[model samples]
Target: MDNKTFSLQTDLALYCRTGLYEPQTSIQEHTFHYRRLVYNVIKDTLRRAFPMTRKLIGKRRWKKMVMHFFEYHKCQTPQVWKLPQEFSDYYQQVNFPFKKKFSFLVTLLQYEWLEIEVFMMEDLPIDEFSIEKKSQEDRIIPNPEIKILSTEYPVHLKNGKEITEEDKGQYFVSVHRDFYTKQIQFNDLSYPFVEIILKANEGCFSRKDFIELLAKYDSDREKIMKLYQDFEQFALQNTIFLGYQI
Candidate 1:
């Protein structure tokens, strides 16, 4: 907080971020050496966080953004788990021209980062029930690691190099850490299925109940059976159902 401390920090930060610092004659060449080290560490961290975004933005612009982040964004959290989120937070308020040209960059970075985030999440146990539920009061608890995302760009599948405005669409997806394999998993989901999962987490609807609830609009048995089958396919994934509550 004092003038001397602030001046020292400001010089280091500027050198690391933009290579624009007054040469400290006291430290001599040692200052430049440390500056390079600091810059590379932060640059590598950003690269690891946003791999796809980095490739899309290319080397020049990606470095620039990272520098911008290093210069303007003061990271308060000491935990490394939060740095990527902080990087994304910096861009949330500042809409620069690159965003207009590459509208999918932020979404791509978010989607790419989510895989590692879920993989590192604390595991929650799920009870496996291979058979149909018999009671109306039984509840379905969604897997604690499951993250449901609705995005304008399909960042997971796309190559991230050639996305234009025409490639945009609403996508419903679920990403979870597999209970058995301990691997990150991804799946496509419909809006209805998402709604079912949300309501199930509240202990309101079982799969059978959801299908039957839809049956009210149309009494078609074939359609109801199809819906039931679809729900089964999704439920086959071990992470989808966290286990039923009595």
Candidate 2:
């Protein structure tokens, strides 16, 4: 075939493979078969990326959701890798009466996504340009890696459902990357305090500023100090506290 004819044929095949039921007048049965193969590839990709999501919805529903997604959305990005996020987004939009707890499922999936994203982050040597290190009176910068820090509520899901208000705001978690995997662990007082440090004004923070930030939150001096010490040690061990390069 000429280049033009080849390109036209390829595009037609891709369109059919993407679940758009185009008439075979311009294409052929082979085009539909090609489309089915594409659907399976996409489905398996989603399934691997979201085991929890699949399990949450169960096999039958999950299959239905994936099928519906394939039928409707033409994911045209060169970064085909982002298909998982798109799937998660679709899950959030679906209003299954049984899925009234989607709010929690969305959050959990988003959290898991962050964990994966962070784990993939390459270590940038701590910036030497300096954000003015907090002293006995300075603020701290929230690390970009810290996603979803809240004063109340550590978001979680139970059997794929979000726990309701009665159990809400009872815990906090700090999600961070460790080498190659995104890891999430419950936050101790120190983790939240690290969050507080990040929340400080955009410049250097002094020791006094740091101390005051803690005090503003009514973080007990003795207790927080102990927590801080323990936390610093933990960060060092985990390679997360990369000592200020400044």
Candidate 3:
């Protein structure tokens, strides 16, 4: 076939596969059969990456949601690995009949996404761990990898069901590598400290200063030191304290 013939055929197949028919073609029978097969594979890939998000909405709604995205969104990356980040952005705009039925469900989906994203999103350069080499007087900036921080706007939940918010609270989440993957988890106090560290604000509170900042909350010196030690251990295990490039 000539170039023009080939181009016209490709365009017609694409348009027909997407449900917008071009002029009727003799080629339709074979191409349309393969089109359904390809589309189903693509949709299933999306569903797997976002299974929790799918379970949040039932199967039928989830399939419709994925189909809408596949039809509308022009995926920018040539690599399929990058698709989940795009899916996450799409996940935010979705509103099912009873979407917020589980108060922390959406947040949990986001949290799970971040855990996987951080571990795989980019490569951290390999480097020697050397925090032990720091002198007692050495002043150090807290490394970014030691902290996973974020804030949710205008909504708060307690016991996973009661939702209300007067103000946004900073969450200081911890991300650490366990075996081959990074894990994200946090307790109430640690979340705020992680947030402060990541903000890296000028005249911002130091990790040591974090204890002082929260002094009024619980003034037991032993407990405060224990918190610091635990976070330090987490940082060390994750290679953040040693300034491993990330």
Each model's TM-score, in the order given? 0.77, 0.69, 0.62
The TM-score leader among the candidates is 1
Candidate 3 displacement at residue 93 in angstroms = 2.9
Query: Where is model 3 poorest over a 10-residue stretch in terms of lDDT?
Result: 153-162
Q: Which pairs clash inside model 1?
A: none
The candidate scoring highest on lDDT is: 1
Query: Please, what are the lDDT tens digits per residue for candidate 1 over residues 146-184?
Result: 788889987766687766678788887788887668788
lDDT of 3 at 32: 60
The stretch of ten residues in a row with the least summed lDDT in candidate 1 is 124-133
Each model's lDDT: 0.71, 0.56, 0.54
lDDT of 2 by residue, 1-246 (tens): 799878766576557545554544455656567667778788877777777767766788778788778776666554555777777777777675556544466665665565555555565433443333444333232234544434343344354544555655544455655422446443434446565445532444434454555665566898656665665456545534433324
| Candidate 3 segments exceeding 4 Å error | 1-17, 22-29, 100-106, 126-128, 131-134, 138-172, 176-189, 196-223, 238-246
What candidate 2 gets wrong by more than 4 Å, as runs, is 1-20, 23-29, 101-103, 122-125, 128-146, 149-165, 179-191, 197-209
TM-score of model 2 vs. true structure: 0.69
